[model samples]
Target: MSRLLDEEGLPPGMLAPLDEDPGPARRLSRQKSAALVQAAVLAALDAPSPPPRSRRRHEWLMGGALLVVGAAAVATWHLSRRSDSLAPVETPVVAVPAVVEPVRPEPVVPAVDSERAEVAGVMRTGAEAGGDVERAEVAGVGVMRTGAEVGVARAEPDVAGVGMKQTTTGGTEVGVPRTTPDVAVPSPSAKLRGTEMLPSAPAPEDLLRRANGHRATGQWKAAEALYLRVIRTDPQAMSAYVARVASGSLRLEHLGDARGALRQYQEAQRGWPGGVLEEEASHGVTEALRALGDRDGEARALESFLARHPDSPHGVAARTRLREISGR
Candidate 1:
């Protein structure tokens, strides 16, 4: 009865029939749900909450990392600076050694042409003899000579090539007295048999006079040769400078030989370096090179002339030529 009252005590019709009392299964399900709830509550209460994140500790960690990065960057900068300090410095100036030139010895002068002077004197006498110089014997200096003794004979061409006429017979080649027969001329040594019997050496003045006379007489070849002879015999002679310049002029003006003119001027320079005619010689060299189509040679010659004779008479001309060559 007690069990009935405890559980099934309530009859369906008893007290308005307690609505369908749950069966044992239903009771068991309720007990199980309550136990699950109790367990969930216990678990919720027992689990330790995650420790609150420490803001100070986070800041410390971030600061440490930043410090390490900063240290690495500073060390890199310091190493770069050290490397730069250890590097070699560049200098603006590069030093080069100076060069020394070798010294050259002075040139020796050439010997004088005494023999040429003697021959010129003889030729002068022959010209004076009206081309009637037959043969001559050399006596002592200032001594007398025979009238028949001649060195050379003067002949005039005959009409229609008939026969030649000698000048010794008073302007007539026909038979005349004092006209000597043509014969083998005596050797120069034979003529000078007597000790220095040849007339006194002709002065430089005399040679220059004869040369001038030849030039005036339209004897261009003879005049040029005579002038050259005077120069060769004695470059230091009073008129040698004039003779050299004149010779070069004749070659250029009359002979049309620029090369020959060039040589004449060069000889003057060689005979008398830094002399009065050096400027002229330099000018001549330039002109000759130009004639030969050697532009480089002409330029060099002009430059050398200017360097040596800056104040020379030809200086202006030389400078002009240099400008032309250099396209200034």
Candidate 2:
């Protein structure tokens, strides 16, 4: 009975003897202890064992290493394919010919008919003038003559179909007919002679006369141009002096250019001091000063003019201007 109660998970002191009369409370207590012991055994049998820490960590590391190796293999394969696709391809080389330029033909110069005829006439005249004539063929078509006086004549044909004749003086002449008749040829000496015959420039007096003609015709600019040409041609001549005076008068009277007139008059005065035109230049200076509204300068110039040329035709006007400046 004690063994049975022990197997049923009962306390040793709770077991009763089998010969004693058992009550219902004792039986119910045994049944309840058996049921509690069976429940505890079932719960202990159903619980799972705890896993090992080192094995779990090792498994996770192996899986991560496999994943990394797979990714590296995939990346290496992709890079290799990309490099192959971008590789350069070789092309065949072809040889090309260099460009050649066409050559141009030289121009052909035609010979003159008049020169050819004159040369032929000269050659015929020399042959008839009673000299020993030794004839030789020149360039297969022309005749070369040797005379009593040492002379040689030569004719040659060029690529342009033109014939050339040369004459030498002891006494020989050769002529070849020209193919073209329209062209006229002049020698270098003739060109120089023509250049020497060109007309010379006009004289200063002629330029002055032209200037006077233009002035009379009311061509003021043209007249001035001619006067300037005369002055430039011969500045020290009487024509240039007259041009200065005339230019000053024109500027003063027609152009109303007091400053330009004064400049001309002053130049004339400086160029020919105390000359026959001194009275005119001095009076022109006074007039220019008056036109410019320089009363003091005009007064001084007038006094000087009167002192210099008292017997002049403009002396009365100079004295009157001086008196006006002095408030007399």
Candidate 3:
């Protein structure tokens, strides 16, 4: 083979062929095997051996390993999904209802009657002002007289700054003064202007405004305080005193103060003797006294006031009330 190989020489390529040649079948010659037991291997040459496992076994092992890994991944995914499905549900956040504080509505103070309104205007003009101490004392004494029995009428001052005897109209009435004398009075509009637009005093509307504001704003204590201050400053403060009387009288179930306020109205009647307000005060006294469980006293006052002031605007109303009281 060496001689035959020498005859063919070598092939033409970048790499020179080895001196030994491995044919298509990697087999040794007879002399190279049994006969070649004694043969010498000049160059060490080797051929690859067959695989240890069969091809079918290798394919089955790879396929089984892939199937196991796929099954494990699918099992893990399924377990995770099951865990998620069974997980506790999240509760929706329910916004707690905002605790709304209730807004208390303001109190309703009755509109000051026009008669009281006019008297309030006169009072604002400082009608018959006295020393503060004397005015306060007079007001206090009037309040104290309610619980006491009827006694001698206290001495009061006439509008002329002179002391006058307080008479109780014991005889035929001398009649009420509703209209001023024609010579002393201005025109209708002028008289109204004189009464309403007092340049020398604060407007009665201003006092009414304050009283209404205090009452409407649910400020009972504040309203009471303002009423008291106004009545004290001007003892003839008709609307303010009347408003206080009304306010005090309304709480009759809780505060039985109508009698005290009724006495105050009586004092105001004396302080401002000759206006439509006097009749109104008398009526207010009648109503308040009746509320105080003294219907008889109320009836007598109403009769006296009505008998004295037949032409008063409220005269008809007073008569109606008297009739009702008499029937009762």
Candidate 4:
């Protein structure tokens, strides 16, 4: 094949190289290339390959976990701090019932001992005061007298023949029998029968409650009577003002007794002058007069109320009523 290639004018080496051994330079070059490829492969394996997508994702996940752990720790610490800051509430102690003991009776003194003690005290007092004290038997009973008493009795002449009896005890009464008494003693039964028990007066609050009950039950007469009684019983009391107003209202609305209502309103105004009920009483008076067809009286009452209490709670109503009654 080489002879044929030379005859065709081909390069003799190109044809001959194919059948020859490789040169040292070519072998060196191939070895160097193989070394470079091995180095590149080792570098790709050992020298930090571009961080893996999984590694970055793991870093992010780890960071998020660290943040979550930090937040949880902070939250736990904050909760613990808050719990420590709060004070513990103290519970109230209940009192136990005390044990009760039975009452003891007082000791009684003997009559003889009491009498002897009294006699001894009297004798001691007589001796200290330089007075003579003597005990003698008179009419089969023991008697005692002082020296001053004996002298006074001897100086005075006794008109009656009644004998005197003395007792050693100080508590014993000296009974002097009288021939006649001015006042007669009443028998026990007669005394007991003569004991007159007055009826108890009703309380103001009770009367008000009863009156309100009756009013609620539509018992106007009974309610009015109770209200009147409360007003009459305690006119100076605050409840009386309420009763008077209630009575006036009952008379005006339920009974249609305008004159009686007007009287009650007037009395309430007099009893509670410039008081909390004054405006109400004045208004009630005007309303009662209006109900009775007394236009001039209504007008006058309204004018008085408006003048006295221009800034009263019912001032507007009073002014309006006055205007209506005055035909203005």
Candidate 5:
């Protein structure tokens, strides 16, 4: 093959046998090429390999998880901020001062007239006695004196006076009995019959009128007594209602007895509920509560009064008092 190659103009060493020893320079070149190829192979083995499809999928999932965590944190922060903004704000409390009312002076009652009261008392007694007593009126001083007594012995008594003498003393007659068979003692049935003929008690209307007269004259005790009599006589009468209300007013204003006045007013209200004078009684209840220093009760009473009597004459005052009690 070598002889053939030489004939074809090929190099002589190119056709050397495979078993023949190469020269040092050729061997060195061959060694260098082998070393370069090994180095390339080692570099290829040492370099990092690309991840597999499954590993790449896991990495993507981790990245997505990280992104989701960041988004969740951001969303939590936004939601917390929104909640803080939407939270209710506390309001500061302010104290209000109480309203005070001015004090007023008490009313003064007029002095009682003695002579007029005396004459009134005498006339009242004579009228109540049912025409049994004789009253003599002195002209200038207006004084009254009792002239005679009823159911007394007379001079010509006991069957036309069998020897009876009439004795007169100080322009008055005195009866004396002598020891005689014709003079007879009076029995107890005769006295009882005489007592039975007297008149009954006065009417409630008359008693109320008399009480009003006494109250006007400043005879407070007498007026109160007569009013009580009227009330006791006829509790359901209109005159009794008037008497109770008047007595309440008298006790509250003139007598300065608030408790007594309250009783009278309450009794009138109970006796005559929803009557013509109900508004007056309700108003009086408020006044009584006010006088007793019961602020809450007074407020309630005033409210009730306004509700019941919206167009009452005292509506303005009732509203004013209610506002005062409520500290408005």
Candidate 6:
């Protein structure tokens, strides 16, 4: 009777059967309920109760204890399930480090034309004889006899090409033209009436006038050489750099002097830091690199230009070229 009542969550008792004659539904007295339940249990066993009727209280306690034990077991199971969900998970890690590299400046190459060095003497001799010089002059310094000497040089084959001629003497012919003493070359010029000029000024000015004339006559080599002399004596003559680049280009293109001519332009760029020629000089380098079929060098130069001069008009052109090269 106790086990059956506990399974149904009810007290361990079965009251008297329905009283059809009752005026209202009323529960049976505790003693009557206990007796009924005991009677049923005793009948099932086919024997009387082993314990006295006082043990009926113990049946209620047994049912309550079983319920408490079931509730504790359910609570413990739920707590264990919740704890599993709260456990920490392990996280994976990656080891990555940032690296920096030092940037290097562009390399510098001297514009010394060794091939031209031999031909230069030949060219100077030709110029001295007023021979054909489509392109003339070196990047740094070159010479062409100036003044009425232009026509005279044209007739003189000896001065056509480059050669070491001693300044102290008329070339290797030592002690020919008498050497002037140091005191002979005066400091400040003595004013003649309202004008004053250095004695040697006549030579350079004459050479300048002659250089322009040669340039007009398409005597680039002659013009170039004269210009170099002027700039050599006067570093402020910025035009010298531009003229050299032009002369070098023509010579290299026409004279098969690719190496020497390229050097000339390269050297000119080093000194020409400003002006229209400077812009042209940059292009000249690109052109030279292309002429040499140095695609890698040309591409690198274009890339460098874009990186350094983002705002330049050429920057867009360079970027466009790069994209084309990249096949984009």
In order, the Cα lDDT scores of the candidates are 0.49, 0.50, 0.42, 0.52, 0.51, 0.42
What is the C-alpha lDDT profile of model 3 across 66-112, one tens digit per residue?
55665665555555557657763532212111111111111111122
Q: Write the per-residue lDDT of candidate 6 for residues 247-276, one digit (tens) a residue.
A: 565445444555555565666666656543
For candidate 5, give the lDDT of residue 10: 33
lDDT of 6 at 44: 38
lDDT tens digits by residue: candidate 1, 1-328: 1334454453222243232233223222222333444444443455332332454355456556655665665555555557657763532112211110111111111111243344445444433332211211121112222222323321111111123111100000010112231223233333233433234544343455556556555676786766665555455543566577666766666667777777766766766787655666667777767766788888988888788866554667778878998787
Candidate 4, residues 1-328, lDDT tens digits: the string is 3345444653222233332233323322232333444444444554443544655566556556655665665555555556656743431212111111111111112433464466556444433332111211112222332222211110111122223221000000111112221123221222223233123444455556656657556787887777766555545567666777777777777787888878777876776787655766777887888888988988888888788876554676778777776887
Question: Per-residue error at 238 for model 3, in Å?
Answer: 7.8
- Select the stronger candidate by TM-score from 1 and 4: 4
Per-residue CA lDDT of model 2 for 8-114, tens digit only, reads: 55322234333322232432222233344434443345432244355445545655565566455555545555664775343111211111111111111112334
Error of 4 at 255 (Å): 0.9
Worst 10 residues of 1 by lDDT: 166-175
Candidate 2 structure, TM-score to reference: 0.39
Model 6 regions lying over 4 Å from their true place: 1-198, 201-212, 252-255, 274-276, 304-328
Lowest lDDT sum, 10 consecutive residues, model 2, at: 167-176
TM-score of each: 0.37, 0.39, 0.32, 0.38, 0.39, 0.32
Q: Tell me the lDDT of model 5 at 53.
A: 57
